[model samples]
Target: MSDPTTDPAFLRDPYPAYAALRSRCPVQQVPTGSGGHSSYLVTGFEEARDALADPRLSKNTAAFFAGKESGRRIHPAVAHTMLATDPPQHTRLRRLVTGSFTTRAVDELRPFIARTTDALLDRWPAGGPVDLVAELAVPLPVIVICELLGVPEPDRAEVRRWSGELFASGAPAVIDAASHSLADYMTGLIADKRSRPGNALLDRLIAARDGDDRLSEEELVSLGVLLLVAGHETTTNFLGNAVLSLLLHPAELQRLRQHPDEIPSALDELLRYDSPVSSATFRFTTEAVTLGGTHIPAGKPVLVAIGAANRDPARWPAPDTLDLDRSPAGHLSFGHGIHRCVGAPLAKAEADIALRKLLTRFPDLRLAVSTEHLVWRRTRLVRGLTALPVLASRT
Candidate 1:
């Protein structure tokens, strides 16, 4: 197979390529864009599921890339976040912050979410096209996360830039600078919280402990940095993708307009249909393992194609169809197993509120330009529209 990384068409619409690859075999070694290395891509639903939950597949970056210069690429400050660590560390980090997104906590934030959505919706000038991503998708999650993390209003914009620069596809030096910049910001933020704590999640993290096994200063900074970046990026993509998916399917949009209560299930379907995180972060094998009938050796980087697995025909009856009412029970959109996204509840709440309120407020919301003109993000990690200019109001 060709390098999917270099294909503009593949980047824009990768599902077709993912489907074609899955048809051949679920587990195939693909060329890594970096240094002639090969990584296994798991495309089948069953295979992806198994890969995500497998203990033999490790999340420790250093453990997998030991003795290789590849490990040095990551900024050491944020390298030890829960997403990059295995159990014990992962379990400890997750426990401290998991309560912040419990069902009750997310429910409590509904009023704030509604208020923020309304405030954003009120800014769109009638009869002029608005870039939905700039005015809405990006700000909503950023503001929510900032409020939750006690990020002062002045620093939020810088935080956003750092997060985007770290994730966006660009020059290596620029990306590395952004990574360290954001990590340094987090280090200072944690110290400030230490001096004067508040009720935000970051403050709680500072005080989190389990039988005297408290987080270290480094762990605190890494956790804050992780939350700052991961917290809003995925949701921003999800909101943009969800809106675009609806606008592309007018009938479905009409259905949502008619039954606003269906927004919950619709969000799930939207998530499965076009997961914000197209491909999950890499996992490396700890031992020889067989997946989808292919034998894989140790230390090989493995990628679970979350979007492909969600659309696997073997798993879903009509995989391509965007059926809002379809049950999205086992979708890997929020991932699976111990490392599943801790912010799933918060993400769902944000999408549900954003979509329902936007649709209700702007019944005529439609694309300002042709679908072909909409620019999709080129980053391999996240799948979303870069900008969604829309004629949101009726003439």
Candidate 2:
């Protein structure tokens, strides 16, 4: 049987595949296409939520692969961030950076985000076909993140390229190379900040201290890399997916355009309808645990299918429909428990500004090509369009 996670057809529209797997059993072992390892794929809503918070399920990827002989080697800088740590370590790392992403902090960035959105939209060709993904979706978050991290204008392109490679599907070599390159780049950037302190977030992070403790060099570099990549990638894909969803569901799109005030509240439904992050990061069982009535052995890797969980029929009525009015109270797109995405506030803020500006600027904006021609990226970790070509209004 083909792996639904990687199959091209499934990649384009994975909901059906997720639904099929979810119907049978929410938790089942499936080949993850990584070193021939089969991971427990958790698809049920309740099951996925519980599994995310389960203490036995560890996120320490480096520790889990310590003795395993695998062809793919992840860099220490990439493998040792808060994303891969548990308990005290994760708590400490999260605490150090939490203030930077608070609602207040993100709100302070609204004017900048608005200016950036308007500038990008201003360049759109009049009544011509444009790839929204490339023109708006990709750069908005990338520029926002770069500004936050104090990355120089000249190096931003390289950072974007390396981050893109990090998420390439079925290319372990490229992923590893990107990880190392990004880590090294961040290490250099951190050193530069240390010598010449600036007012950017990276400078604050470099100077951050917790009593007698501070982030080590490796942790600093790792966190920088993590923030750079995670800070924008998810939001980039999210902008693309949210735009596509709105375009596809014209009713909802029109409703939002008519009542612009609803855009903020509508974001939750959009996220749940077609999540940008298909699956949460890799997690391993530190000890045997039962989830969804399935017994998973210790040391086994688990994949919480956020995409599947969000669309579970049991959790939401008419799971496949895009209903803006629906209350998306418990979607796991940003995840659950301690490991939930730290930059979610920023992502939401960017999306809010981008959508409001883009839709208002080109009220008649629409897909430029047939839906069949649209391309979805080949990665299972993130669900997004490679290019979202759309027609913009002349005005």
- Per-candidate TM-scores read 0.96, 0.97
Query: What stretches of model 2 exceed 4 Å from their correct place?
Result: 34-36, 209-212
Candidate 2 residue-wise lDDT, 98-212, digit = tens:
8889999999999999999999888989986999999999999999999998999899889999999988887889999998999989989988887888999888888863224
List per-candidate RMSD values in Å. 1.7, 1.5
Which portions of model 1 show Cα errors greater than 4 Å? 1-3, 71-73, 209-213
How would you encode candidate 1's per-residue C-alpha lDDT over 208-296 as one tens digit per residue? 73126488877778888998888999999999999888999999999999999989988888999999988888799999999999999
Error in Å for residue 43 of model 1:
0.7
Q: Ten consecutive residues with minimal summed lDDT in candidate 1? A: 70-79
- Model 2 — which ten-residue stretch has the worst lDDT? 208-217
